[model samples]
Target: MDLAARKYNFIQELSSIDENLLEKLELFLKTNQKDWFDELSIEEQKEIEIGLKQADNNELMTHTEVMNKFKKWH
Candidate 1:
């Protein structure tokens, strides 16, 4: 589906995958988080740290929100 159409469809909260993709993502997160975190370099660590800081401050949005931001722009 077109990304722009996804955005205005939900002004209050961002959009998400249509259940099936999210199920795959949930399984991926469950199985791969350790391998993923372990492979990150110092720079990627710093970026995640920044994101965590923003999240701590309630200044960060969900991954879906970030995707919405870029998918619309791009």
Candidate 2:
């Protein structure tokens, strides 16, 4: 189904839910609405920072180069 139709159906379902469920759903949505990066480990964040710095410095290799370099792993 399309997003609009799905949203309408979801709203219809939400209308039938009790106040307690609606409050819990609201809290769930609010608590879960964090940036994905904020959930990453410190090591992962450092690795991403390093990659971004390398990219900014134009220290990138081509897709073919990366695939060829790591081909043996597969």
Best by TM-score: 2
Error of 1 at 30 (Å): 16
Q: Which stretches of candidate 2 lie over 4 Å from their true place?
A: 1-32, 70-74
Cα error, candidate 1, residue 61 (Å): 3.3
lDDT of 2 by residue, 1-74 (tens): 99999999999999999999999999999998989898999999999999999999999999999999999999
lDDT of 2: 0.98
Q: What TM-scores do the predictions have?
A: 0.35, 0.51
The residue pairs that clash in candidate 1, if any, are none
Error of 2 at 27 (Å): 13
How many clashes (backbone N, Cα, C below 3 Å) per candidate? 0, 0
Q: Model 1 Cα displacement at 73 (Å)? A: 4.0
Q: State the displacement of the C-alpha of residue 64, model 2, in Å, after optimal TM-score superposition.
A: 0.8
